[model samples]
Target chain A: MSALLYLVTHKLKNRVREIFHRPSELVLLLIGAALVVFVVFTGNLDVDPGAVRPRAELSAIIFALYALVFVLTAKNGFVNGASMFSMADVNLLFTGPNKEKTLLSYGLFSQMGRSLMLGLFILYQYSWVHRAYGVTLTDLVILLVGYGMTAFLGQMLAMLLYSFTSGSDSRVRLAKGVFYGVIGAFVLYFAFLVLRAPEGELLPKVLAAAASPVLHFFPVAGFVRLGTVGAMELHASHIAIGLGCFAGCLILYYILISVLDMDFYEDVLKATEVSFSAITARKEGKAQEQAPRNVKVGKTGLGKGFGASVIAQKHRVENRRGKVLLLDLTSVVMAVVTVAFAFFTKQPVGALVMSMYLMIMTIGTGRWAKELLLPYVYLIPEPPFRKLLYMLREQLPALLMQSAVTFIPLYFLLHCDPLTVAAFILARTSAGWLFIGVDLLLHRWFGAGSNKALLLMFYFLFCSLSCVPGAAFAVVLFQILFIPLSVSVLAMAALNLLLALLLLFLSRNVLSASESNNQ
Target chain B: MLQVNHVTKKYGKLTANRDVSFQIGDGEIAVLLGPNGAGKSTIIKCIAGLLRFEGEILLDGFVNKTLDAKKRLGYVPEMPAIYDMLTVGEHLEFMLRAYKMEDDGTADRLLERFELLDKKNKLGKELSKGMQQKLSLCCALVHRPSVIIFDEPMVGLDPHAIKQLKEVFLELRQSGASVLISTHMIDSVEAYWDKAYIMKDGAFVAERSASDTTEASLEDLFFALTEGGADA
Candidate 1:
């Protein structure tokens, strides 16, 4: 126990020391903290102080959003396959003389870092959520606390469920029942909202339904509401109830773990190995590292390639995942949800948000596509540029595939201009290429040892920069030529294409430079 | 067939491999015997053309980093670089395609020899560490390079795989291929090495050939240079 404590402290101290040593990372942290602090203190990230409590209609709707978020967390916890035990802990603490209690302690304590990260993200989302949901400063703070707690509970639930349900028939069925019951509540609520609302006045009834006490019965939804219900209504029992529920959950999870009798070594090891590989890949600038999927292995082979089987090999691996699922079911589900959101909210930005999401998924800001990590690449007899082109050839088509699946739905739902629709698709596709260009540029300039935060900052900066020249040219052309906006979109596309070619030309030596550095 | 001359590798202020020079002629098996952090892997990497070095390394008279040199050189890295998604058979196919070579049944032969033919359907992630090592060796040997480097090849292997590896090394030497093996286990390679270079603090302290007059085994000589005697 002492040794584990010492390890924890030593790691923390080393991290702080490392941060101080790297001024780039230190500055990045400071700036981010400053921004959060600035936003919170100025009271801008709250609903207008002069504003009154929203009507029953609006409160209900806002509560629906909260419930939506809660259910998503619980569902995510249920589905994600990884155990909370990291590779380092598995290597160190699992083999150590600690009891399961100590191991659980370590796992929960480790979750604090993730909670802190989520809290920061919540802080980032504070302003929009404040307006959209009409939450006060106190309400926002409570919600942040609730969100952090929810995230922690989600992790604990994932661990517990993973252990408890492993190879158990009844438990698996019960788990299925609980998940469906949670989701079914929302579906039933939506249906009721539709039936109960006055003719042609849907939003108000939906909002009213959200504030109903009916939501306080669902497990995560109920628990999270308790955390914030106090701030919304000045009731003291809400806080007590929320605290009691969370505490109860913790105790129940511990008891469940005690009773489960699971030998989770293999699960922990698989996760640890994947995470370790991910970290190594990150260090080597192989950015597209993802959550390891349980790929059903059957008939896997590099069927063929045009002297570029390196690319073919990757495609083969993806193909084993099945064509529809190659982009991942989560991504496809998110796309569907986005379309549903657009249909309901009647907002075009939903599509844009989905596009941005897909861009991040495809581009993987940090991952430069595993070209440098594996040695066989450097050992390959092909020309560096040809190898690079083949790699891009694989990704560009993948980006197109992802775009087609995500965007094809938006055309029907968004009743906008047809050329505008085309522009969005082309522009989103171009964004993925542009992001890759920026990524390659960052690697060419900084190498793999570059601070991740600072590198990410510069990466987004470069992506924005790539678009600037084209956007500027489009604007100038629009003013001079009096062209239609669709033509401007075409102009933008031309410049983006030019930028893509230029970036490829400039960073063509990425392979050779990375090879030299890797040595 | 492989020559490394004055190879110096530096990572920032730390010189991992300093002025490391050695040669292995065709039909010769050279062993790099060193303790952990003795820079054996660094030099092996330098020779493998994976790292930039201050000095020259030539593979069969070709500059080490050239496509031609890379084509003729095979390296099994210390840690097996297995693609988690690829099956054993796909890994070999990928290697063959990368080298622009046709399948000559070499992959199958090597897999059969290593007893890995049965596990060809398994994904790299599903394979145990020993299997991954054997698979790595199979991929490295499939290309049939003129020069080969193995880093800790025997670490995570079944006894059978280890025995097969030893047989492969002998066969490689017999076929006139220069082989460099970096390992900390002194006795494992003692029976097979024609020459051994004992390393300490990133430099070779002693070089001995089987025909040398020194009566001490490689272990005794290694300890003498690394720990027993304090060099002035």
Candidate 2:
């Protein structure tokens, strides 16, 4: 058997065995099965164009797919790469005496598998799709099919683009020029249509224009938009164009292989090296930053050599060499974009929601959390509690800075009460501490070397369980005791902090020498 | 002095090291010689306090994994654990802070001796394998611990670094610091080992002093014992 086929078969067999054998996973599967049955039989999935505007929904879909495409393009760019193969594939399949096109097929197959996994996620959002977009079951199914197809098509395009452009700088620039030209032409075309339409009907006209076949679908940015919109609306002309474009994507995806003469082994090795490093870091609950390298040498100094001062100084040096500071350019851009979103949506909580997204994202970036993965942190000859405090000092301040950037804007824009601003900031910071505390507790109990999937499951469970107590307590306290909102939020923050401290204390010896490598 | 008493390490059902006991006194060099999967690294990790085992380890008089023992112990792990974000110089600084000791020029001396002074500003990730191994040695040597452990210390080093490390082992032994080294390389084991233990199947199968039976060379004796009735 081929390496790719063998791994895929082996993994599928394992997954099936796990589903069939394990009681917990089996129960979850059964519940999901029951939910699907319930939805098919008695679920209220009816839709009415009478209430919601289908055009606006179409507009949302177009913008949403565009955003996804934009991110996909950015990730597949030379500077920021993407991975579609496992390390095993990189090692075994790439090194095998196979053609580049064969490897490409393997990569494409893996991408389709990923899309299938994500399709399950889309199925879970069916009710929201029904309620928000007035999409019926049939519309929802078509939409999901469009989504999976588009994702597969996007990967195909990315591979072709990467294969064509990545070998040199001039080629990359040329590729970018062509790409931006297409987007620019579409933009101007879009502006022309919208401007020519009557004042109240611009969006409807733009939506109609987006579905038209003048936009070629193989280039994907415009064609994918056309195909997806066509699928959602069940337009015969649109579906025909969509299927034709999809077929074109498949053919071009293969043709590009022979045309570009892609060095699949080299490309995969590079991709897999990066992917494996990230996977390793994430598995160890570490930050995902490019490994620091090629920095200008400076004088070695650990001034004062105080108890925790060295850690703080290390951060400063790291910031100087790499992006040690949390509030770097990316944070600035994220803040601007998030604030713009809130302003455009005219939703005060949108700011908070965006901030929460930023919070979750920033947690995964460079942080003290990642420091634990390296053995030095554990091997450090210091009091575990003191070391813990030192790490917290570095981590908590960054969390605070992020929260300040997030909620401080809301304080002014929403004209929130002083108490509301204070509660929001404290509650968010408390949530950060709660995450660290639970992470430490889990690391101590489960061991840092635990399987990545199991660790993630525990992390999700903790995120769920941790949110319940504070929110539940606040809600029940408000309904029964009639506490003021500020007091309730403050009390919840205090409760979270108390729990965090208790957890930290309980897991204080997490980095102690006695702790073994069970990973 | 470093002591590992009846150490037994298991990974679920597989025993990596079992009933392994050994000791090295002050100013003594001990070598644990084994082939791949011969339980050398497992025993070394158990001694370095990186793995849990069903036994006891002591550095000087303190429990090996205790903070007190950690302060006195320096370990050069089999695989150099490079901190990507830290430069060569900063790694030494980090050791100083962690051990709560002033540099007193020890770091500079080690860096200078290892010929890494020119590359002190290079981050851990920028260094080649040889450089990484040299930096690992520098990190382990900076604090001037009373006990030091090296696991396959010569594996990735260039000839220059291998020579420096061999010199370091002798110097460490001369300074009244006990040194425990684990390696399959006969040459690395030949010059430094005062006491040699051949390990296989998770336990020490044979032990001999440097003064014991010079007629049979270490390599010849190793192969004979390892491939003999014990199937070591």
Candidate 3:
């Protein structure tokens, strides 16, 4: 236990020292802290003060989110178990002279820290939450505590379930059956409530169902939700019952582990290995996460191209496997969600903006980025500029397809002219190119010395800076030239495309200059 | 043929390879023997045109980064980096196509030689580490490169595959291709290397040839150079 404490303290001390050692990372951290402070104090992300949402509505949303996270976490744990331990922990602590109970406590302690960190994401929404719910500091802290507890409880339950059912097929089956049955019952109960209501508006009935005391009796999510809602509404009994239930669950888990003397090393090993590999793959910018377990080697060859063009062919083949059309599952989902959002809010352009933002956020995870990390892209016998163009070939088509799928429906929804539709599609697809350009430019500048936090800060900064020229052009065309909005949009799109091309040409040397430490 | 003229590479202030000059002529097999952090991989990467360096590297009398040179050069990285989505067979085909080589069953033959023919249809992710290394080797070889480089190639290879790789090196040299192998596993390359360079502190401390090392084995020479002080 003392060793574990020493390890934790040293790890924390070193992590702080590491941040300070990397000046750029330290600067980024400071900037992040400044931004958080500004946002929290401002009580708004933007000029418009957030509209106060109903407390029941907020409660319902949080409850739904908590429930979804719990279910997914449990399902994953059922198969692979929950891993609070990393590969290093497995290698060092698991093999060291430490009691199992102490090690378990250390794992849970680390897990609690992670849960707290995860809960901090909600702090970024401080402005909106405070404005919308009239939340005080104490209320916010209570909610944060509730959220962290919910996360911790979910993992604890997952660990217990895994330990109980591991290595026994019948036990797993029975556990899963019980799990599904409980979930089914809750859904049925909610549906029954909604159906039996006096049927004026659907939302009130749903919120009423969410606020029902019956939900507070179910499990961890409910208990946490009750505590949070109770805190928000200042209900003492609700808080006690809700928080007491969570504490009871934790005590139960501790007793089970201590009494059963469960050997969970094997169970967590698989999850830890999976997590380590996945993290490594992400760090190396490998898009291997999308790969299905069972790949059908339908075709055995690239089937086309020589030299640099084979890269495009390789990407095409990989994309084909992941998608039926040019649009993959994610694209389809984005399109559907965008259309639904537009239909509900009657804000086609707003939905288009949201979808484009989604695309921009995800551009770094594409195959082109992965290509740069691997050796073949540099080893291929071609001019750097030409190789880059070929590398981007597959991305362009997919971006176009995604934009078309996302925005074409908006033509009808917006009741807009064809030119307007074209302009929106062009702008959206062009943003992908611009973001890709920014990614390449950053890589070209930083090369192998790129730090994630530093690069992320620069990535956003560069992206925003890169958009200025096109935006200025659009503004001039629209405000000065008296051009229609669609025409201005088209002009902006053209400028963005040209800028992306220029960036591509400038960043071509990234292919030649970039080095992988893996070598 | 490959020529590395006074090449130097640095990562920030740390010099990974300092004024490293070496050459491997056609039909020759040269091994770079170095301890960890001895700059073997750095020099290999510089020669492969994957890193920016101060000096010149020429393959077949062309700049290493040029199309002509790249076409003739093959590099197997120290860690096998195979595409998770691409099948083992597809990997070779992609390499062949990338190198503008005719698909003349070289892929299959190489797979057979590496004992990867049965798992040719397996996705790269499905193969074990040793198998992935085998696939990486097959990709590098399918192009029939005139100059081939391997960095720690035997790290994950099975005994049979290692033996097969040594044979392949001889075959490649017989075919008049230059082979440069970077490995700390001195015994693996002792039997066939025409020349060996022992590197320390980012520079070659000693060079030995097969004909010159009659009095002392490569193992003894390496220990004398690398571990002599620690031993004393």
TM of each candidate vs. truth: 0.85, 0.82, 0.87
Best candidate, lDDT: 3
The candidate, 1 or 3, that scores higher on DockQ is 3
Among all candidates shown, the one with the greatest TM-score: 3
Q: lDDT tens digits, residues B1-232, model 2? A: 9988988987666889889888899999998887679988777767777677788999998997788888888888776666666788888988898778877999989999989999887778788878888898888889999999888889888888888888889889899999988887887669768998898788787887889865577787689778874332
Each candidate's fnat, listed in order, reads: 0.51, 0.45, 0.80
For model 1, residues A1-519, the per-residue Cα lDDT tens digits are 488688779988999998899888799999888867776666465366466334453344335445555555545434443456677788878887878777777777877577656666557555544554565567666766776676677666666666656556788789879877767876798678668877765545655556567666666656566556665677778778878888888788767765665455654566567667667755543433342446677566676773654665565464554342336655565566556555545565446555554455347522236555667766776676777777676566666666666666766766657776666557666767777877776766774345668777777667767777777776777788888765776677777777888888777866653432343
In each prediction, how many residue pairs overlap at the backbone (N, C-alpha, C within less than 3 A)? Answer: 8, 3, 0
Q: Specify the highest-DockQ model's number.
A: 3
Q: Can you tell me the DockQ of model 2?
A: 0.44
Which tens-of-lDDT digit does each residue in A4-100 have in candidate 2? 6887799889999988886667767776677666654554556666865565545445545544554454447454345678887877777778777
Compute DockQ for each candidate against the true complex. Answer: 0.46, 0.44, 0.69
The residue-by-residue lDDT of candidate 3 on B1-232, one tens digit each, is: 8898998887787888888888888999999997899999889988888888899999989999888888898899887878877888899888877777787988899999999999978888889999999999998889889999999999889999999999999999999999999998888887899989888889888887778845578888788888855321
For residues B52-155, what per-residue lDDT tens digits would candidate 1 score against the true structure? 67999999999888888988998998877777667898889888877888998998898899888998887787888799889989889898999999999999
lDDT of 3 by residue, A223-312 (tens): 888888888888999889887888898889877865664677877777788888878776654445366545666766778888889998
